[model samples]
Target: MTEQFGLFDARGLQPADAAAPPLCVRESRRARRLTLRVLPPHTLELVVPHGARAADVAAFVHRHRRWIERARREIASHYSLAQDRLPTRIALRAIDQSWLVRYESEPQAPPRVRVLGDELEVRTRDASNRGADAALRAWLCDQASYHLTPWVLREADLVGRRPSRVQVRLQRTRWGSCSSSGTLSLNAALMFLAPAVVRYLLIHELCHLISLNHSQRFWDAVERFEPNYEALDRQLTEAWADIPVWAHPDARRR
Candidate 1:
């Protein structure tokens, strides 16, 4: 799941192109801003201050298309999702072993999935145009709560600790994470997996609260909660690879 558009994202894409809906996500650092995030499915994001015009961002993207495209090409997901249309269904093979495929669609949308019994399943319904992305994103957040809450509590109880809060949201890079202040951030994407796999992410993040690093002790902490952490980690390690074709980073904004 790649955000084709957002506030100040810095990925370079021109809306004029019927090939792909391009937009940029803005990222700033040290008050000197010029970072653009080309979102997945291939697009550009322009990084600017709080008050920036989309038109100005578009110009910036036009200025940096080469760098962005290079980065997009480096990311394997973009290559996989080069051709797609809005509100469409796409079938693809997931590189992750946990689940063979996924159906990204609107909330409570029809069962776009057709299970052929273990072979593989992928039914994607695009809502990128009419806020289907928003709908799918909301469902993903709720699903994360439904799946991760108990798992978090279970791990906390085992170590005689309780989490002060749980945060579930979309993150392009991380599957699950935890903070030292007893707050946990989990990727809503876990909803795509079976319950067992979700449990693995829970223990892994909670253990971070204790060890704070991926040391042997941290792994041991994870092992204490789920003995098969290594195996589960292996499964999750390569997940999210089946994300569909989108676009490449705009050449102007990298």
Candidate 2:
């Protein structure tokens, strides 16, 4: 047996049935677009093409109640988080001879960056939603520009090389990259890293302003600029597991 209820909100009404029938769900209405998103634990996010009626969508949801709930319930159990979630923090050393940690909040509180005394706050409105990664990425880029730019420029000048641009992104893959066009891109995640590692990555990218490929020449250049870089590079490589999601091969050894 399924429960039936009407969903009321500022937008209007919707169908809320724990057990409904199988009906064709339409999302997009105005344009030639239609898709169904199962909001687990028993809800369908229907995207209708423009000019679609909510009544029709609600009816559709009501028609497919049981099947939708069954499917969504399983999904929800795997991914859904409670309203009150704890922050996961990582201890890091700041450049100003200070220690800090960065943390992410689930059901985040709007997009904002804050330094609560010594803690670096990366607040996302919804860690379970789309904008969390992007918001953090933007904040990190801003932080990188502010903290790394002076150092990068100084090194560029010292090395007699000029960079064309600096870009930042959410890279689950690599760290910094240097293109043949004198453009440099850095991982926004680096903001969560120790300042020393961040500085080393910056110098690594600037070194690429000379050698696009990693070779003995590049190593020599890196060592020339930052002696003891080998040890720093090793540290950076080991720090990959600092991000819980990244599956580092050596992470298990630690």
Best candidate, TM-score: 1
The local lDDT score (0 to 100) that residue 119 gets in candidate 2 is 73
lDDT by candidate, in order shown: 0.52, 0.53
**Candidate 1 lDDT by residue in tens digits, 87-134:** 233222111233233445555554343435443233344433333334
What ranges in model 1 sit over 4 Å off?
1-71, 74-129, 242-254
Per-residue alpha-carbon lDDT of model 2 for 174-249, expressed as tens digits?
A: 5667777888776655666777777788788888777865557976898887897877776665454454322111
User: What's model 1's lDDT at 72?
Assistant: 53
TM-score for each model: 0.51, 0.50
Off by over 4 Å in 2: 1-137, 244-254
Q: How accurate is candidate 1 locally (lDDT)?
A: 0.52
